[model samples]
Every structure is written in C-alpha cells, then in structure tokens.
Target: MIFESSHCPEDSRVETQFCQNLVAQANVDRAITPERSTSISPDSIRPKPSQAIQQIILFTPSRASNPQIQAALVKLQNQVAAELRSRGFTVQSVPTGLDSASAIAWINRRATPNTFALSLQTDAFLNPDARGTAAFFRAGDPQRQQQAEELVKRILRNVPTLVDRGARPDTETAFGRLPFVRQLSVPAIVLSVGFSTSPQDRNILLTRSSAIAQGIANGLAPRPVQARSTTQVPIRIRLNGELSENQGFILGGNAYLPIALLNGLAINFQRPKTAQLFT
Candidate 1:
C-alpha cells in the first residue's frame, strides 16, 4: 500500500497511520479465520491446505532521519501484519527496509520451505504524468508469473481509476536485478501501488491505502469454503480400473470387511502371516 502526503510530513503521519489502522480494521471486520477451516460439502472438491507463509515488505524511499515517514511505516507494517496473521498465514512485515538489506533478509527467511516475499512501494517519478500501478515478479517462472498477475487483478478490482500498468521483470532497479531477483530462489514481487507524482494516482494511494492492503490480504489468504457435515458412508474399493459396486461399510470412520460377503466379489483374498495364529 502506497501512502503520500500532499501537505508535507504533517499529513503524511495522519494519512499513513490511518491507512494502517484501516487495514487492521477491515481484516477484523472480515473475520479472517486463522485455521484451515475447511468444510467438505457434497459438491465440494477435496480440501486444500492453507496458503503458505508469506512476507510483506512495504517500502518508501528510506529517509535516514524522517521520523514521520519512519513512524508511519512502522504503523503500516504492524496493521498489515495483524491482518495477515488472522488469515492462516505466518506473515512477516518488513517496514522501512528498502535497499539490498531488505532483499537479503527475504533470502534468509525464504530459505525455509513455502515462503514468498511481496513488496509495496510508492513512486514519484520526475514525470508527473506517470500514473498507475506496476509490479515485478520472477521473469521466467510460470507459476510465480501467474501469482503476480492475480495480484494486479485483485488489487485494482475496486479501484478503477488506478491503471493496471502490468507486471514487469524485476531486472534492473534495486529490486529488478540479481541480488534481488535473479539469484533469489523464492517467489518475490515488487508492487508500485501508485505513483505519487500524478495527482490522480497519488490520491488513489492515499485514500485507498487500507482498502488496497485488505485487497492484498484477501488475495493472499486461502480461498475459504463452506463446511458440510461429514457423515461416514459406505466405502468404495477400487480394484484394477473400476470401483466396487458396494464393497465395504464405514463405521466409526473406518472401513470394515463383511467377511461373509467377501467371496461375492472377484477380488483376490488371502490371509496374512499374522492370521495363521487365528487359523
């Protein structure tokens, strides 16, 4: 989420803090579930596990001594951190670390399995005409590429004014190149939510900061489904290439053999070595 202040540092602190608080509030309102609370409906497919742990790295052009900017960043990351934690993800928010160190820290964290890094940034290009959102993802990886594209669709779904600048290759900037992109093994993306130079773009970022943050959390959260009562029914045994017509019964969630009817099926049956004791 990008936050800008047209009124110097004064508005920056208020707007930035507001944005963070909004994300936290929205997430709570959404009632995000921390567990993989999957309910198997009659028509539902097999349940999938929760989304993997993710890292959100929100940045600004780091100022060595800008207290307002730094404070806002801390608040922003904190709110987003709480939002993500409620959604069944082990999330870490890296606020104010904008250079090589931030990217390096991502490397150390993503070394563990099932981890990804996402960044939010604000831009004020010399060209005030610059507008819209831009994102960077792993250049050649298809799965990572799709994740990047999905982000754009989700983030800008409600904000119609913000143009979809498209996902780009992280190839040349502090984030686009080797230390950050090329050699970084984990999936990573840098999202320029909006350019501050353009009045229109700047307003979108400042006004919709929490909404944008919520949009991001929603995108990253596991797709939840309605739960259905699980009543154990007859168990079907598939042998060779076909399923059993009515091969077994389920009781106490376990399939049991009706030994008297076993000979009716063509399935081969044999006693195990342990069964010799009973014989």
Candidate 2:
C-alpha cells in the first residue's frame, strides 16, 4: 500500500517517529553535501592563472618631441618590460607614439585591481645640468608616495652612481597634474630616469641601462609580508649556567640579546655609533 507521505506508515507511531528522524537526518546530510556537476566545460573568457597576478603596464611618452629623447625612452621602456616579464610579471607593453589621451585610455581599458602602470620618460631642462632619477606620484597619496620612494631607493641601490632626486609630488612638476599619475584607477607613477639634456646623466642611462632595468624590476617586485606575533616570547639569559639579570626576546624566530648580556661571553664586539645605526 502507498503511504500519503514518504515516511513510514502512520499507523505505527514508533515506526513513524523513526522514519521521521531518518528523513530529517537525510535532509541535513543533503544540505551539508557540496554540490558537484558531472559535466565540465572550459571557459574561453577566463584568464590564465599566470595573468591574474603581478600585472604591469609599461609605456613611454608619445609626445616626446625630441627624437633623441624618444629613442632613449623607448629603448629603456622595452628593457624594463623585458626585465619585469622575466620576473614573472604579466607585462603589457603599450605601443610608442600614442597621444597622451589615447595612451591613458588604452591603459585604463586593460587595468585591473592588480595592475600597476608606469610611464618611463627622460627629463629635459635647458640648464643641461639637471640630471638624476626622479619619481612622481599624485599629491596627497601616501601609498603612491611610498611606492615612489621605494622605486627611487631600488634604482639607486642598483646603480649607486645615479644621483637620488628623491620622490616628489606631481604638483612639483612644470605642469600641475600628471595625467599618467592621476588619471589611472590603479597605482601609477612617472619615472624620469635621467635628464637627456645632461651629458653625464645621458651617458649613465645609455651605458647602465641593464642595471637600471634590474633596479626598476626590483622596486616593482612584490615584497613578502612578514607575519608579526603580538605575544612576546621572553628568552632567559644564562652566564656560565647561572641565570643573568638581563633577558632577551624572541622575534620572527630569532633571539635578540642585549649588548650587556654579552659581556661574559668572551666575544669581542664594538658598540655601533649613532650614525652607523641610522645608516
């Protein structure tokens, strides 16, 4: 005989209750089980795994009127793009000679949350002595300011000979706002590698192009975030098996000991001067 409900016969209360419990358990099990499809289809529109991270858009000024400066900027731009790609970044090399508006439009079209844009260009000045590496970010943006600072730092570290012009706001530029730095939704910067007008700086850019590219790659490379523990682990110090008054602390898996605790260790060391510490 067919029952009205899918449960056990209602005539037997015990059997009905047991069936009800079973039904409830089965419903819960079905709810918790993850849904899976037997058939799978590939999505052509999905981006490859490698394209999802560390995407960089590299470009040079299309309005570089000076033939010499334009050539140098393009050469440097290509080198930087190659270097970044070698480091596993997805590099989009925007073609040279696109007008400012066109270039910005092209970049914004492809820019994602993970994308970073850099405009590589050479500075020009009538003084001819204006030479050095400078980076500009939008004014009042601390994040971009830090990024600019790091970029300059890495470039200087790679090529010590190049003078550090330091990171500045776009407001300091001849034109108040840099479209490349301000227009993009993603973080962007204008890197003036060196003054093409300066004889010394021009020579360095031409000769030390590889080192500069490596430096730019290094600066753009993502740094691993170090996890810091809120709980401080105290390390006990012992002098010849006797507990000493001074104690050390464990941080980032390393034990840091006080200088005073090293007195009886028979190790000779000089205290670092104030200037040395800062350096």
Candidate 3:
C-alpha cells in the first residue's frame, strides 16, 4: 500500500544539502510575500456529494509555540476555516497539546461513520521545501472502500519514519511526509500538505488530486467503467515545455508509473512541465 514516488532521491547528505538550499530559497520567497487565498473556484469545479462527505478538521498545537507563530496560526486557521466553509464543509478544530492519546481521543469523539477527516498535526511545523499539502479521492467506479483505507496507509506510513529520523523543517517536505496512525474505517479522503524537493513529493500531490476528481465524478455521476475497459496502457510521451526533464514516476488516469514512456505519449512534456504515465 506504500505509494512511493519512483523518482524520490536516494537518501544522501549531498542531496539533502541541495534540498536544504531549495528550502531556504522558498522560505525567503514566501516570507516577503502577501497571503493570497487559493481554492478550487466554484465556477471551475463542482461540489462533491455532501451525504458521502464527512470532514474533520482536527488541529494539534506545536510543542514550541512562539508568539509570532501563534499569531500566524490564528491567521491560517481563519483562512483555512473560511475556505472549507465556502466548499460546504463543516469544520471543527481541536487544539491538543502534543499528546497523541488525547489527539486520538478527540478525533474519535469528532469522527463520524461516513465522513472525511482532515486531522492537522499541531506538533509539526509547516515548511515549504520539505512539506507537501494535498487532497485525495478514489479514481474509478467500484473504488472499494478498502482503497480509501489503503491510500491513507500508503500515504501516512512514511510520516513518522521521516520525523523520527529527524525530518528537518525546511529540507524534508511533503503533505504525506508526517506519520499519522489512526485507523480509518470508512471510505475517506485526506487533504495533506508538506515539504519536499523531489518530484516524488509533488507528483503525489498531483495524483491525489486526480484521484479525488475522478472519484467525485464517478461517485456523483455513477459512470462505471466497462468490464473489458483498458485500465492501463503503456505509452511513450514526448515532454516539451515544463515536463521535459521531470525526474519521477508519471501518473495518468488513475496510475502512478515510471518515466520510461514519456516519449510515447503525445503530451507536451518539457522543462518545468510534468509528464505523468499510466501504470
């Protein structure tokens, strides 16, 4: 169930150092920047089924809470709350002090039988470079409930390992980088954010979104794939603009694949572009 980016760099000090540099640059860039609200515009996107959607916004406080950070937290919480409400989500916040048991108990109290839960680990600090944030959903019809469970398992399994191994604030990032150990019993999607320099990190975000889009479309519209439908095809795609030199697995349709077939597909894969393949 481990969904790893095929292109994630091997663990090395030099590679880590390069990643650290990128992290510093990104932070500096964001530091002087104004806060802008971003969401899937209603005109461009449709809503998911409310009955099928259960959401939990659990907040965990960091172990070290500075005044500046606390102020920023207030701002982010307000922004995130407003954004979720606009998307028709009923948001709930839990401020748990670095206590895993208390956090779990709070979430258990708040979680519903058929709802999507967004648990924010308050203990972890947000870093742009080593972290990623994203949302995930099912891709195809008959998307077994187990698929949702497995996705969480695959997606969250790596978080704690990295943190335990000293995941730096700036250098190691991805939404799925933090380890969360709650057993999800229903079909649910998680919107995760974290820092990462590797394409594997970004690609995971892209694929997770694609899955959510596909799932919503199928679940709301109920268009089943044919039994004999081709779920996967080996394609050679030619990268042009931004996707030309992306070093990672390519995701197409509902699959995450290696980059071998980039030249086979007719996608405009170029530098600064991403060429995702179907596995």
Worst 10 residues of 1 by lDDT: 39-48
Using alpha carbons, what is the TM-score of model 3? Answer: 0.32
- Listed in order, each prediction's TM-score against the native is 0.54, 0.60, 0.32
Q: List the residue pairs that clash in candidate 2.
A: none
Count of clashes in candidate 3: 56
Per-residue lDDT over 1-279 for candidate 1, one digit per residue giving the tens place of the 0 to 100 score: 332222112235564466555546544533564221122123222212214555443334354444443444345455556767787666765444556556556555545456666665555444577777767654454665676677777778756678887776543232113234334445566666766557787666556666676666665664577565345466667767887675666644556665534677655788676642210
Candidate 2 stretches with Cα past 4 Å from truth are 1-53, 222-279
Candidate 2, overall lDDT? 0.70
Q: Model 1, which residues run further than 4 Å from truth?
A: 1-51, 54-76, 95-98, 106-110, 172-178, 227-279
Sequence-dependent TM-score of model 2: 0.60
Q: Which candidate's TM-score is highest?
A: 2
Between prediction 1 and prediction 3, the one with superior TM-score is 1
The global C-alpha lDDT for each of the candidates, from Candidate 1 onward, is 0.54, 0.70, 0.38
Off by over 4 Å in 3: 1-51, 65-74, 96-98, 121-181, 184-192, 195-279
